[model samples]
Target: MKLVIVMLGLCCYSALASAGDNSKGKELFQTNCAACHGEHGEGKHGVAPRLAGDASRWSLKLFERAVLSGVDDNGRKLKLMMPHWQNGSFKGDNGNAPSKEEIAAIHQYLKHPR
Candidate 1:
């Protein structure tokens, strides 16, 4: 019985960890991503490409990799200015880097821009 309880508890914890919340994503994006990417993801002319429609087409895995590693979907390395938010290890003056779950939430929010 104790073993079953532990297993169930672990499962619940895992589920909570994996779940993504778009509201949180929006907040993170506003603080972290909006500056370069634009508040509405419109992109800054030549500064940064538009991510509103583009990022939504990417798979979650690829999106996570790009955000964490500063790589694009085409395997090209992004500019140095792009910060790597690997596992929430991204250090910057503006805001928190974003955990894996937060990345998921960002992806979800990007799917449908407001």
Candidate 2:
């Protein structure tokens, strides 16, 4: 009985689903983002950003834009608050950005974390 139970537990743990196992992205966010972005994904009033939704607040493509180029979705002056990602703006404190493959993982993690 004890052996069976142990095996069962191991199986269940291995079977656990990882939503977009974007650990790197998640870690990165926690380190570099949690300050402005909320720990639970909730956004603050001003300081940094609220990444839950509100693409229009900046722009739908702003994430990619902000990552690659310094332009906000609206194509206005770059806000001083948002740092340029390419300029080594992201310190080593956090994990690196998600790759294309990891986007789904990151999204899954954000949408549903284990």
Candidate 3:
């Protein structure tokens, strides 16, 4: 029984560590991405592609690359408008770059926007 409990606790902790916080994601998106991606990630016409469900097929690594390096899944460079966020170009939240956890949260929100 103790072994089982320990296993269950580890599983729960792992799940929590992997999952991103939806609320934090929404806030970060609104503060940093909404201007270009739209309030609900609907995207602006002639500016940015719609983000809602756009990354449904993307792995987290690919998403991270695109966000942090401006490289698409095809290994091609994204448009110039896409900021390489790793450079800390974003002006939101005291102009600091988004952490990995924060990026994951944004991905979660984009994956399942409410």
Candidate 4:
């Protein structure tokens, strides 16, 4: 009984840790990405591709590479308009690039935009 309880507790904790915060993601997207990606990631035609369903197929590592290194899932360079967040070239309102956790949150929000 004790072992079962401990296992259950571990599972709950793992779930909580893996879940991303969508609300915070929405706020971050609005501040940093909405300008280019649109309010709901509808995206501009010639400027940027729609992010809504496009990113759903990407793995977290691919998403991170695209955001931090301007590299696409195919390992090709993305458009010049895509900012490399890790290089500090594109600062948010807080004057800093988004952290990995924040990026994960943004991904979660993009995966299922409300």
Judging by lDDT against the true structure, name the best candidate.
3
Tens-digit lDDT track of model 2 for 35-67:
775774566776655555543234324555654
RMSD of 2: 6.3
lDDT per model vs. reference: 0.78, 0.54, 0.81, 0.80
Give per-model TM-scores.
Answer: 0.71, 0.54, 0.75, 0.75
CA lDDT of 37 in candidate 1? 92
| Candidate structures ordered by TM-score, highest first | 3, 4, 1, 2
User: Candidate 4's C-alpha lDDT?
Assistant: 0.80
Error of 4 at 62 (Å): 0.4
Clash totals, every prediction: 0, 1, 0, 0
| Candidate 1 Cα errors over 4 Å, as ranges | 1-21, 87-97
User: Which of the predicted structures, 1 or 3, would earn the higher TM-score when compared with the native?
Assistant: 3
Q: Positional deviation of 41 in candidate 3, in angstroms?
A: 1.3
Give the clashing pairs for model 1.
none
Give the Cα error of residue 40 in candidate 4, in Å: 1.0
The positional error of residue 103 in candidate 1, measured at the CA in angstroms, is: 0.2
Local accuracy of candidate 1 as per-residue lDDT tens digits, 26-98 = 7777777888999867788767888889976799989998999989999999897887776354334345555
